[model samples]
Target: MPVDHYTYRVTWSPEDNEHVGLCAEFPSLSWLARSPDAALKGIRSLVAQTVADLRENNEPVPEPLAEKRYSGEFRVRIPPEQHRALAMQAAEQGVSLNRLVSMKLAA
Candidate 1:
């Protein structure tokens, strides 16, 4: 598959004074160019070469984040005090802590 099929982002970097392109599946890699289009092209080429190198070495290539499946659940860590406050709020609203958090996140 073409590297462009993967998740890509191009953003301006004031420090570098250039556009930076990054691929979500290859977080360690980046390409900088004068223009957004050039940056994207450069990053895509880099990703393609990286994929080829991995394959040549018989190493596993990471699946694109866009192609991965999510179970609609993830864990988050909160401070004990915040956790207690949220639990009390959930109780006041007659809902489970999970439901209360879900509602807040959706909002």
Candidate 2:
């Protein structure tokens, strides 16, 4: 039940006028503070509390994104015109469409 590996991020929140911390595993939970460090700590503390509560209640806990396995393959749909454009670009670059898309995405 370790939560340290859970994906965490801190960013400025325009609406709240403060830094906000977010956890990927628990999207519904967040912490707002005046500083990024405080925001991060607050979210981590909140997550620990939430995890303890969940375990106490016998509720299922979410798997951390870092602990999940990915196959490196997923399908994405785009407009036919965009598809054709990418295909043409891939051909011109002497690469497969998948490779072209992967390079673009990586960039």
Candidate 3:
């Protein structure tokens, strides 16, 4: 039987606008994006690279991620006044709320 595995949740604080970031609850790896879409893309790429590295070094592959499809979560808070502006940007770029906040923070 294949073993079931769990993914860690990464959280970011919206309290500080100057230095926002995504941190994995388990401290695996973190990446910065200019938008939620960018961040999502970055995370996906990171995981794929990690897998390739593991295989190249002949390291034991972790279950769950090693065999199944994976998805991650990203969250953010926005002020009521900025909702319209943010929505427009997200629609224009076709990204998520978490990504937009991350990208703005990164910039």
Candidate 4:
């Protein structure tokens, strides 16, 4: 798989005095370099090598998080008092609680 297909991020680390590259699908792996681009390149090479190693060992490689599907819906638990307040507010607006929450999230 192409390294671009994976979720990668580069961030500066004050402690290390360099940029660090991280791959979401391979949390345990990291690459540090003086520049962000180099860090990213290093991590990408590492990921490709790791995937190849896994394949050779007959081990399962994790799918890239960027390729995963997400449902638009998810559940969140809230205190009863907070729930009641939201419900009352939704009622005053002539909308369901779910609709109100969805609108707030979109904002």
Candidate 5:
């Protein structure tokens, strides 16, 4: 079987300590690395894992030949106190607020 591939333009933005952050058009998928090339390589790894997961779970894989891009937006609301707590916890854990939220939601 041939594995279909989708191309994504990943941007590397500098973070603290000379590390760079990888950002894709898809918000759920990003990574941080010590170098720009490493960040882009990390993006490929992440995308590959996502594809594998979709296949393993028998989820419908979007036909990249047709749907070259996918985008969506939604709003999430939380109590102000709870939001502040999460932010503090994320900072303590040395991760982004978005990452902390993602892990919590995934669980």
Candidate 6:
């Protein structure tokens, strides 16, 4: 099931002063606990219950981020001047503009 592969994370929340568990697939839902382990468990259980409820209601569940395939292609718009500069840099580096941008984004 996609729910089993859903992206999960636990991080500290200074505002709440407790650990927070999060699911990328369901951004609106979260679990809080004193410890990271408990937080993670809580979130996982919450996700399971939520998934069950969604299924019971015949609602479409979100696709798991880990289970989704990415084409590694996307479009972005930048200022003309910045675009020209990147082109010049690409020329100087002897690489395609796409390669130059990809390298910069990776860094």
Candidate No. with top TM-score: 6
Residues 4-107 of candidate 3: C-alpha lDDT, one tens digit per residue: 13253334436532222232322476556555655555655565666668779998756554445556554556687798788789889999956876799889
What is the C-alpha lDDT profile of model 1 across 17-79, one tens digit per residue?
A: 999999999999999999999999999999999999999999998887777899999999999
Give the RMSD in angstroms, all C-alphas superposed, for model 2: 1.6
Task: Kindly list the per-residue Cα lDDT of model 2 for residues 1-107, writing each as its tens digit.
Answer: 58898999999999999999999999999999999999999999999999999999999989999999999999998999999999999999999999999999999
Per-residue lDDT of candidate 4, residues 4-32 (tens digit):
79999999999999999999999999999
| Candidate numbers sorted by TM-score from highest down | 6, 1, 2, 4, 5, 3
Residue-wise C-alpha lDDT for candidate 6, range 1-107, written one tens digit per residue: 84669999999999999999999999999999999999999999999999999999999888898878999999999999999999999999999999999999999
Task: Assess every candidate by TM-score.
Answer: 0.88, 0.87, 0.40, 0.82, 0.44, 0.94
In lDDT terms, how accurate is model 2? 0.96
Residue pairs clashing, model 5 = none
Off by over 4 Å in 5: 1-4, 14-25, 65-107
Clashes of 6: 0
Q: What is the lDDT of candidate 3?
A: 0.56
Return the lDDT, model 3, position 28: 72
Candidate 2's C-alpha runs over 4 A off are: none
lDDT of 1 at 94: 100
Q: What is the lDDT of residue 77 in candidate 6?
A: 95
lDDT of each: 0.94, 0.96, 0.56, 0.94, 0.67, 0.95
Give Cα distance to truth, residue 45, candidate 5, Å: 0.5
Least lDDT summed over 10 consecutive residues: which range in candidate 1? 1-10
Tell me the tens digit of each residue's lDDT in model 5 across 36-107.
Answer: 677677776776777778899998755544445445334699999999999999999999998898899889
